[model samples]
Target chain A: MAEQDEDSLIGYDPLAWMHRSDFNQDSRKAEVGESEVDSSTELASSTETASNLEIDLDQAPADASEPYASQGERAVLVLEPVLNIQNVSVLHQHLMQMLSNFEAIDIDASGVTMIDTANLQLLLILKQTAIGLQKSISIDFPSDKFIEASELLGIAEMLEVDQAASGFF
Target chain B: MSARIVAVLNQKGGVGKTTTSVNLTHALAKLGKKITVIDFDPQSHLAVSLGSVDPQKSGIDKVLLEGVSLAEQSIPVRKNLNLVVAGPRLQEIEQLTDGGARRGDLLRRALLDGNRDEDFIFIDCPPSSGVLVANALFAADEILVPMTSDYLALQGLSHLVGTIKKFESALKRPYKFSLVMSRYIPTRRISKEVLSVIQKYFPGQILATAIRETALLAECPSFGKTIFEYRPGCRSARDFMALAEDFLQGRMM
Candidate 1:
């Protein structure tokens, strides 16, 4: 099966998405935030708030929920394969736990073969908050599906952008 | 006090537009030109090439659309090179429908008001002609078209020129531009023939520097560095240096 997968990628260039370089018509009017600058101040506060939470990665939740595993200052938060709004709350909870309990974050995303903007937005905010708190955030053992979703969303940086896998087809 | 806005443009993909944008910015900075490269392409390869942007950071698109200042969006890549990354929010440009004329002037307004000290601004355009490219064409003082020696890529010139002409006619002014022959395979006979063909069509418009195809271009991006910082001894460096000098001297060669 692995052999078949590898063979299928022959002549399949991974960085080929770099070529879809087209500007859309009337894109200048994109609607969203009205602030001229990014919401850095809000993101900073949100990050700090997340860090200040007393939730422990290894601590058992009040209900039957996922647990975070700690590895010496770096707490690991593995994500589920699908990360839409339906599952975003659980991921968000674990994310908060990791942020609050650890000085550094090592996210294991091998199981996160799928993701959505809310999850990515959460990660983006978490990374920003980690930066403000002088904490480190890195993706541990990123899966192919994880990398693809990140690239599709143009948030590869959130994955810490796997260099070796950057061109994976 | 004024930065000369140059849009590195071409409608074709994989022809080294991002490579040229990042390296040329590096080369100009080496020659003491205060420069900023706006990764206008939503793919954000310019940021990847130079390792300039943080994954969580929003790009210049925020400035262009949301009223963010250049100072807020710009990241210092080196001594004189500042970079404005293209964030995922920029992908929103494809579907935008509200602001029209204000949007057209957003980049020009940003460059005019926000960036007064830089000597040059390089906008790395995407491969397809769209609203983003239109904005770039409207804002740029000059356009640099990077094309491979392949014939299919050559077919894009008419469309590109036509687009630019439309911009010029609408804006009631001309946008100066040049052709950059990228990924040139020196040993390939087609490369030389295409070079002559381009020269024949637009005399004295092609930059003298021809970027040779090399593994270094692909390798540097993986390391999140420019050709200058990654493998300075490579020919890619030499080509960009020559291109920069030629640019400064008007590539009088």
Candidate 2:
């Protein structure tokens, strides 16, 4: 019985409701003969409208072309098991300092078991800063928690989450 | 017969929306009725009260957000009782500004096929008149309002009735509206006055069994147990059984 039920859901798309509006917008854009809209630009527009975010990206060091870690040349930051509201501020401050010194930072998020909007916003700010400074920011071994949260907010593409990195594939 | 969908709603916070949903649904299920309780509230308090603490669990949020089969997301919590925890990112629905009328009707559409086998489907709604509550209102035929005996509660009740009435007028159908007196303190004169006031306006609408306030009732959720599981043979358990019985008899309209 369970197998039958599972089979019934073979082609079901859970996020279809979220895309209905986007589909309409896309069709309207197509009707007007507009160029294909870049999803990253659309994500940036959505983020710009989010007045609730506390992260001020304007103050981020724009010219981050040098590596700052005095501890080591290959600065790999291992994330904690839980990156939620409780530690978002400290993580934000740490990422901000890292962005100022490191031209490229590798974040090991394999241990993140819990994540929320605050932490996701903090990471997005770091990503946007890297893009502006022409620096590189890569998330390695993204945990299911991080991926689910980013996808839930419709920011997985913006976060550049490689779902294949989960190794469940 | 298909399940009678009920939305356990009260715009006022701390009025026992979770308590009534968890206990009343459990009581009914214990009485041999097939029941499904959806933790429609983004806070997911009903799921937590039932001992499913993992917020990552895909639940009614998956049903509403992703259109997943409700049956697929249901977690069997008790005999004849299935629970669907509010999945992660449910709060994002409240922040949504798009979808127009489609967003409000998501729950109603999601339950179309999955609730056919259940005898009762209860949705524990959030404590605010937002899109989530609107979805609950749209999906449910009955509105089970758990009210407390106090002036502020009375004020909140009036606003909730107005919201329900607006929906009824818009849909051109009256809901099977019922009120459950929660956190009752019979020793207090104010309780009697408040009950009398509610009775004067909504006579025969309040259930006869008043769930008196108790610390044990409050403590059960912390242990992830319902009243029946927490204190199987206690006063609160008896009160909830009576409330379930009253509900079964259709004593309140």
Candidate 3:
């Protein structure tokens, strides 16, 4: 059964792996206080292995939620992961919690140095949900890399950023 | 002296909004006046054109979105000319207008706090009448509309003028406007007719100087240059310089 699951997830785009590698190199320096794997190599290897497992779609294990994810209604969630982890169940849960409470969500990623395909997909999913429910969701202060990633994906318009109010974050 | 805020706005894209902002700021700077150019457009083309700084690296979006101080993000473009670069993160700032308190005044407060040492501030408004433009109008003392010589340009001028009037009534402040003829071709009869019609409607609000249609203005940005820097003696550059001088001498009135 494990083999069947592994086989099903095998051809996951190799480009994703490349993105993960580039993201790790770019973001590893700022992942402090967010992940136990301090070294860039360790963070990359651990995330790759976790991604290979293709964890179930249900809630992520409590240990996985550690620093990148928080269960708060109005609190600002900071995702400072060093590498790109394929499953962003923790991030999705954070957005769902914000939706349930009808609270404005502000994601502060100023400390983030890199992001992978999983992180990008998580943002898209959150944005889509916010639009569908007509809820006010905002990605507070994203770093340059985060902005570049959004522009690359052609979703820069959806972010709804106001450059003037940036000083308050 | 009270700082003057002028917004270079035209709803229609490619109508010389950015060009006017960049050149006007430079022209004003040449007069020994301290000027700050705010690139309110998320596209960040103004920053690239004047400062040669990448918007992503400058963090102007942070100042607007996270309350980052303008002093921290303001990049010096040239002597007496400073730039507040816009980045992709501005998209988040636009969404803050969910029926909030003083949505239009947020930019006004930011500019007031940021512009301590400046004499004049020029805002390059985006090509839409969204909240960003509203914030700019709330902060500005005067609005300058740059229009090309076309029938569609007249449509844009009417809508923008109406919007400005509405803003003036709501804010209970006098909103002054001047329409500038841009990309004008001398031999075109339609251009002349459009100019006559605008003058009939706006009367004395039209500036005397018209920016002749030229390719130099469009090509300068790709080379990380302004027309003044690329070809100071060229007709386009000289015309813009003259316009800047006329503006300072209060010739627009």
TM-score of each: 0.59, 0.60, 0.59
Least well predicted 10-residue stretch by lDDT in candidate 1 chain B? B94-103
Lowest lDDT 10-mer window, candidate 2 chain B?
A: B162-171
Clashing pairs in 2: A14-B66, A68-A101
Global CA lDDT computed for model 3: 0.64
Tens digit per residue, CA lDDT, model 3, A59-90: 12346433222222233345554436644664
Candidate 2, residues A1-169, lDDT tens digits: the string is: 0021342321222112222232233223333321322221211122222211111122222343422323212234657776677667767766776677555565667567888899888888899987787555766546767778889998887887642133110
Task: Provide interface RMSD per model, one decimal.
Answer: 16.0, 21.6, 21.8
* Full-model lDDT for every candidate: 0.67, 0.72, 0.64
Over 4 Å off, model 2: A1-169
Q: How big is the positional error of residue A9 in model 3, measured in Å on the Cα after superposition?
A: 65
Tell me how each candidate scores on DockQ against the true complex: 0.01, 0.01, 0.01
Interface RMSD of 1: 16.0
Report how far off residue A30 is in candidate 1 (Å): 30
Candidate 1 per-residue lDDT, tens place, A1-169, comes to: 0021342322222112112211111112122233421221211122322221222312334343333334224343545567687766656776766677565555656556577788888888888887676555756445667667778888886556442111110
Where does candidate 1 stray beyond 4 Å?
A: A1-169
Highest TM-score among the candidates is held by which one?
2
Highest lDDT: give the candidate number. 2
Q: TM-score of the candidate numbered 3?
A: 0.59
Q: What is the lDDT, from 0 to 100, of the residue A43 in candidate 1?
A: 13
